[model samples]
Target: MMASALLAGSALALSACVASLAVGAAGMAARGVAGTPTNNEQAHPAAATDCSTRASHYGKVSIIDVEQRSPSKIVVWGTADDGKQRRSFECSYGTKITGFKLRPIASPR
Candidate 1:
């Protein structure tokens, strides 16, 4: 029980740090059952170009994973429309998109 409490506290701290630095601090949700990938076409462009939009479009964008917030870029991940695999993307803040990729779901052990 104490271990879980400690973990929760740590997670809260981490998310707070990420939120202040960037935008969405999604990590815990991604750790669970991730969303699947989709080729909906409509969401593709926004997911590629905008970080925040991608967070809403795909699912989770790990602002916490991002080291440098500014001119560097930020990465976010979430389940896709397909509802099978998890999609990870690196995009600028409403500027330019860098990369997008789909990763296999990590089932809970």
Candidate 2:
């Protein structure tokens, strides 16, 4: 009888843990912090181009990733369609775009 009670208590505790985790995950999803892209990001795939015109220097390109380091600084990763070269750009903005730097990233073989 004691063993049965212990098993029941364990099951109840496990269920409570699962429920709390589910609630936390749901809350994160609702706040757009669950690794899902925000609506603006989904709608504008080429938003990186706004940061630097050099993004198209190698011809048409596709943005791979965008990281906002702060309210005024952003980094973008992209690949050129011409030679498939991957590159990264750091952009700093003030009243206008103040700084832009390009860094070539070697692609994996």
Candidate 3:
């Protein structure tokens, strides 16, 4: 009898879990159907925090171009400096950035 009761309790718990998963999937689909940014109340870009901020003095950044080299790789080209001088920098993002390619410039753009 105890074994039967345990089995019943296990079945009930599993059912609850399945129901919760279905609800979660439905909510996600509804968000897609609504065609909204989903975070309209938020005042920042979702990936703003993901961007690297290690440039010198946090100088102005202008994205010259962005290219997706692969499914998980992106190449970013731009220039940054602390007003003393300007430099062109290219940053590659994949599993990790194993390189730093920077070239000095005579002026800011």
Pick by lDDT: which candidate is best?
Answer: 2
**Against the true structure, whose TM-score is highest?**
3
Give the CA lDDT, 0 to 100, for residue 5 in model 1: 100
TM-score order of candidates, top first: 3, 2, 1
lDDT of each: 0.50, 0.62, 0.60
Instruction: List the pairs of residues colliding in candidate 1.
Output: 35-79, 36-80, 36-83, 36-84, 36-85, 60-77, 61-76, 62-76
Off by over 4 Å in 3: 1-52, 56-58
What TM-score would each prediction reach against the true structure?
0.29, 0.38, 0.44
The predicted structure with the larger TM-score, 1 or 2, is 2
Predicted candidate 1 versus true structure: per-residue lDDT over 1-109, tens digit per residue: 9999999999999999978766433554564456543333344344443655655466554443333343334444444433554554444322345655555556557
Q: Give the runs in model 1 whose Cα sits over 4 Å from its true position.
A: 1-49, 60-62, 69-88, 92-94
Mark the 10 consecutive residues where model 1 has the least summed lDDT. Answer: 63-72
- Quality of model 3 by C-alpha lDDT: 0.60
